[model samples]
Target: MARTTIGDEPRHADYSPCEHAVTPSGQPRDPQSACPGRTTRPVVCNQHGDTTEAHHF
Candidate 1:
């Protein structure tokens, strides 16, 4: 799988802000293992100055 930095623009065209999953390392989680009933909130990185969203499973 490809890895993205904190400020990196979304590589996937299907990027959705309403739902997402992130690991403890602050990386996007694998879709197959993601939780279905989880809700995500937007994430902001001060160092990279980028805005993103993440959820927990």
Candidate 2:
């Protein structure tokens, strides 16, 4: 599947904010594998071994 970044979404990207998107990982999806119909917020994360502005996409 094509993955997208939080701040780099396309012009008409069919994306959604995932609750489990607190880390800079692969495709943003919930534990059940889902997005949209959900909520997200900014959080300080170091999941990738670096301090980055993490949030939902």
Candidate 3:
């Protein structure tokens, strides 16, 4: 495949927030209230995906 020029790199500037109602961790996309204790939410990204572990079981 032909390589893309340095100046031709794809842009994420146009990327919009995911239409997801909630994060993959089940937390609200836009949190309205705080939980009682510590939160163990997974950090999700389009490039890398969600974290494997937060707190030890």
Candidate 4:
């Protein structure tokens, strides 16, 4: 028999839904910022690769 993948399974149950975040520039926020109730997302500078976390009100 052929192996079945998760995507091949029938959708029967409702999965938990989550809301994605967007940055001030209207881009999708980083995955690391997925923490709940977290207002700030850390940004890493590509040039220096320095990461800094900022907090929102």
Per-candidate Cα lDDT values, in order, are: 0.43, 0.35, 0.37, 0.36
Q: Best by lDDT, which number?
A: 1
Per-residue CA lDDT of candidate 4, range 1-57, in tens? 543222111111232222455555434467576423324333434333323444222
lDDT of 2 by residue, 1-57 (tens): 454323322111233434345234344445565543323233323332212444443
Model 1, 1-57: lDDT tens per residue?
444344333322333442445665445577675434223343445453436444221
Off by over 4 Å in 4: 1-18, 31-57
- Measured with C-alpha atoms, the lDDT of residue 16 in candidate 1 is 42
- lDDT score at residue 16, model 3, on the 0-100 scale: 27
lDDT of 1 at 46: 45
For candidate 1, the C-alpha RMSD (Å) to the true structure equals 13.6
- Over 4 Å off in model 3, which ranges? 1-20, 33-57
Model 3, global lDDT: 0.37
For residue 37, give model 2's deviation from the true position in Å.
Answer: 12
